[model samples]
Each structure stands twice: as structure tokens, then as C-alpha cells.
Target: MRAGRLRHRITFQVPGEVQDQQTGEMVSGWETVWEKVPASVEALSARDLIAAQAGQSEASGRMVIRYRAGVLPMMRILHRGDAYNIQGPPLPDPDSGLEYLTILVAKGVNDG
Candidate 1:
């Protein structure tokens, strides 16, 4: 794994319950489990297709980073202030000796 490729700053956020002051309802909110994380991000070719869809401005991309525990598809990633919802399960790539976690991210969603 090249250290230079993992230069992009990213963050891992998961849904958390927060009590609404007025209604007392437990509202969903994003809690940053990890911040300022290092990752290698790349825009997938199909991202343009996702972004072109009507009534949706979301896009898709790929991120490569060192493996860590406790990250799931339910969690979303924030890169450069853009929210990306995990589209699928995390795959570990050991074929190239990178042994990195490859995550598929969809852009523009996960605001909730």
C-alpha cells in the first residue's frame, strides 16, 4: 500500500439516536465514529450515470483504506463534506498485497 494514495481525509459516521428537545422523540442523527481518517478515494466511471438521474443528485464512488473493525454498510462516509452512503458490503482486497478494505459509496444521500 502506497502511503501517498491514502492522503484524502475522510470520516466514518453512523446513525445515532438523539432526543428532540421539544417533542421528546428520538431523532436519528449522524455520529462521527471516526474522523480525519486516511483513505484513497476514486470516482467510479458509473458515477456520472447516478448523478444524471432525475430527482436525485447522488453519485457513486470507491474508497480504499486500511482495514478496521466495526465499520458496516449502515454507516456512511463523509469525504470533503460530501456524504456517501455505503452501497454494499466491504470487501477485503488481498490479491495485490494491499489487504485494504474497499467500500462502495453512493453520494448525496444519508442526510438523515
Candidate 2:
């Protein structure tokens, strides 16, 4: 992957459980896992978005980043004040598997 393509910055968050202050009950929350990570965010085309919506799939975009381990489908990506839920596991570049990761994401979704 070209360095220029990863011009956007993104943050990754993972789901966590925290205790409620008053009730002392465990509640789902998000914890920052990685911040200010270089990435490339690409919104799906209108046709693709519509087709995915028709199929009841939430995927609306994709984010590419330099190859890193431990990225999972349960993680959430924050970019430009928007929260995107990961649609599936990170996929490596088919041509150069170690170069980068392609993550399917859905915008405007709850992080946890």
C-alpha cells in the first residue's frame, strides 16, 4: 500500500464492561484501544450502499490501515466524529497479505 493513501487518521475502540456508579451493575462501554492511527476511510458508492441496505447489511464503508495484529470484528472505529461498527474480521490485502488490513464498517451505529 502506498503511504499517501493512508492520509486519514482513525481511532479504534473495544467493548468493555464497567460497573454503574450508583447501581453497581455491569454495563457495556467502550475503551480506546488505539488512537491516532493512520488509515484510509472510503464510503461505499450509492449503488453499493443501497444494495447493502436492501439486504439488511449494515456495512457502509471500508477503512484500510497498515497491517496490525489483534484487530477483531467486535471493535469500533472512530473517524471524523463518526462511530463505525466493524462488520467482520480484518482482512489482509489479497495481493500483499502483510501490507495492510481492510475492515468493513457501518456508520452511525452504537459503539457497544
Candidate 3:
């Protein structure tokens, strides 16, 4: 099988409580910031998607993504103008499944 090249924008939601210091009042409102993480598929290893992000190679695949250690609760893989949301624990391994590809915007790295 041939590895596919993909690109996607990962968005992260920031959480915080709103409050008014002037009158010590609790503010009720929804505030969120969207961050775009651009990833490029550099190489594919049957088990991983060798991606180039922030001038480095990061392995991303079913298993690697499922068992990713950190604050990545949700991730979306966009390709061909479509988005696929990846969820659940780390994946066991790569399978003969289809993925997507998308055009990412020019932006800085994601420091999450």
C-alpha cells in the first residue's frame, strides 16, 4: 500500500472562567480562541505518518495518535476539503483505511 500525503488544521479550544473584577461579579459569556496547526505529510511508514511540523518530523497514525500523551483531547484530519475527527484511545496500528488531505493556512506553530 502507498502512504498518502495529507495536510490539516488542528484547532484548540481555550478554557477559562470569566469574571468582572470591578464589581467582583461573575461574568457569563462564551469566549474561545481558535488555533490552527498546520501539518505536512513528509513520509509514510505503514504504521505512521511521518509529518513535518515546526521544522521537525512527528509520527502520527492510528496507534500513535490514539496513544498520544498530552492534552490532545480531539484532533481533526482534513483532506480534499473534508474533515475527519479522530477520537478514542490510541489506535492499534495502521490499516487499509482511507484518509484525507487539505490545504493548511500559513501560520506559526501550535505551542500546546
Candidate 4:
């Protein structure tokens, strides 16, 4: 086996309220942002073995998660040929009263 890299591009939206300067009114909408992350896996490593085993199972599994603030429509970029096990939840800005996009990634065996 050879080392592999996985690339992922994850995206999500956050709820936000904006005030109109002229009308003095409030408006709500979904803001989107994206981020790119790279992960590498070595063949025959513990991580790789685990990922392969997980992939073999038909059960649902957990994923790795990450969050970013002040960034809308969150996204991720994973490297190619690598397996990933990731997950995340929204990173909310209390002051702004908005949630951040959560990204999740996971590794599994090829079912095909």
C-alpha cells in the first residue's frame, strides 16, 4: 500500500440578522462560507487501519468536527487519495447572535 491524501470542500450556512441603516429595520438571512483543509494518511498505520475497519462496518460512526468564526458558508478542502474522519458544530458569535457553519469528515472503506 502507498500513502494517500484526501481533500474535502465542506460548506454550510449560518443564520444572521442585519439592520437596515435607512429603514431602521432588521432582516434575517443565511450567510455562507467555506474553508479548505488537507489530511494525509499513511498506508498500514493505526489511523489507516481504523479507517479501513470503520469503512467495513455497516454501522453509523462519528466524524471529526471544526468551526470558524466571522466566516460564512463554511467549507473545507481535503487532499486526494486519503481517508478522513472529521466532524464539527457551528461556532456561534454571541454578540452577533449567529452560528458558524459546522464541518464533519469521516473515513470508511470503499463499499463499491
Per-prediction TM-score to the true structure, in the order listed? 0.76, 0.80, 0.25, 0.24
For model 4, what is the error of residue 32's alpha carbon versus the real structure, in angstroms, after optimal superposition? Answer: 1.8
lDDT of 1: 0.81
TM-score for predicted model 3 compared with the true structure: 0.25
Give the per-residue lDDT digits (tens) of candidate 3, residues 1-112: 1222214444433334567678887675323334444444232353333343443233333212121223233434433343333333222334522232222222223222
Residue lDDT tens for model 1, 34-106:
9988999988675555654553234367888887877798999999878999876787886853468888778
Off by over 4 Å in 4: 1-5, 17-27, 37-112
Q: Residue 9 deviation, candidate 2, in Å?
A: 0.7
The reply for model 3, stretches above 4 Å from the true place, is 1-6, 18-34, 39-69, 74-86, 90-112
The C-alpha stretches of model 2 lying farther than 4 A from their native spots are: 18-27, 50-56
Error of 4 at 107 (Å): 17
RMSD of each: 5.0, 3.1, 13.3, 13.0
Against the reference, the lDDT scores of all candidates come to: 0.81, 0.88, 0.34, 0.36
**Cα lDDT tens digits for candidate 2, 1-112:** 8999999999999889877789999998888899999999999888877786754377889899999999998888999999998887888999978889998898876856
Error of 1 at 57 (Å): 15
Ranked candidates (lDDT, high to low): 2, 1, 4, 3
